[model samples]
Target: MAQDNSKSELKLTKYNNILHTKIYRIEINDYQIVELIALKNGEYDGYLINCIWKINKNQNRTKSITQKIKIQNLTVKKLMAELENGKFETIPDCQDLKGCIEGLDGTTISFYVYKENISRNYSYWEPESDYYYKDKIIPEILQIREILKSINHEFDLRTSFAEFRDNLPKGKYTYGMVIIEKK
Candidate 1:
């Protein structure tokens, strides 16, 4: 069953209000990255990087797109102000991932947020593992992912992730996603 998230969405501060994020993900055949950054002056920058190495590593195809998008939305603005005003405190670090405990080899997801001076990441071993679905999913993390995904809708940043998740071969597969924070 899909977990209830409405109440969790109301409390972004409960987890943390983030502005910049760097999501690095790995799967059996590909590696992808999503970066989102926002500065104190209200400037926003984003990038989507995808690398799919076929069965033959030498035949790898990589695509990287960079954009300094102009976003105009009140909900986005309010979310930003919440960061600056402290209604949402910045989550300087990643949460401890507790969902990857089955076969020793499975998919792993590591989400992170970094600053000029430091970086932190949250990791989940494999969404297909025994303990995978049991983890206390963070509604805030999911919210941030959606926000970033929406901002980069033109790039079609999410379809591939969903595809990969849906096509996982059993060994230990998981969904892939990322939300970047920028200060």
Candidate 2:
């Protein structure tokens, strides 16, 4: 069955060492790769994100694995490099975050989050338009748009305004979303 086929293709290994590593087997189509990453915060002991990434590709099979990490212990220039490298996203614009990025050899990495949009013809209601969503939504929309542009314009930034907006809080300005433009 399709479900069993999917299940058989997935494998995960847990390493509870002091270094905090977990390995995963990922299969898509006929390709498969094994990967791992470090966990931080109070999150999952050692797993950083819900998804694992291939850090390096070796012989089309093995790769150094990685996961999204907060821009906690890196630097601004470093963070930009990581963004270019697709390691982290949305570097916060605050003193702590600035310090976090600045702490790592002047090179900090950050992680970004994105979601797909599903609203019907929501583009028509975009801030630039007068479609009448609300006066307040415009600020949020502009904020999100600026973030999207910063991420997409340089440093190999990946993600879009539509994807960002769809993930915003339905009716309020949640501090959770931020635009991390490389300075």
Q: In order, what lDDT does every prediction score?
A: 0.36, 0.27
- Stretches of candidate 1 off by over 4 Å are 1-30, 54-104, 127-131, 134-158, 161-183
TM-score of each: 0.39, 0.19
Q: Model 2: per-residue lDDT, tens digit, 1-183?
A: 013332233433333444332222112112221122333332221111222212222312222122322323233233234333532233333233211111212111222232122111111112223333343343434443453344335322223223433443323221112222211
Clashing pairs in 1: 19-181, 19-182, 20-180, 20-181, 20-182, 21-180, 21-181, 107-172
Error at 170, model 2, angstroms? 38
> Which candidate should be chosen as best, given TM-score against the real structure?
1
lDDT of candidate 1 over 1-183, digit per residue (tens): 011242132121211125433221112212444444454456554434443221223322222221222334443444344333431234322333332243334444444444544455544344333244454655444543443444345444457544543443433221123222211
Model 2 residue runs over 4 Å out of place are: 1-137, 155-183
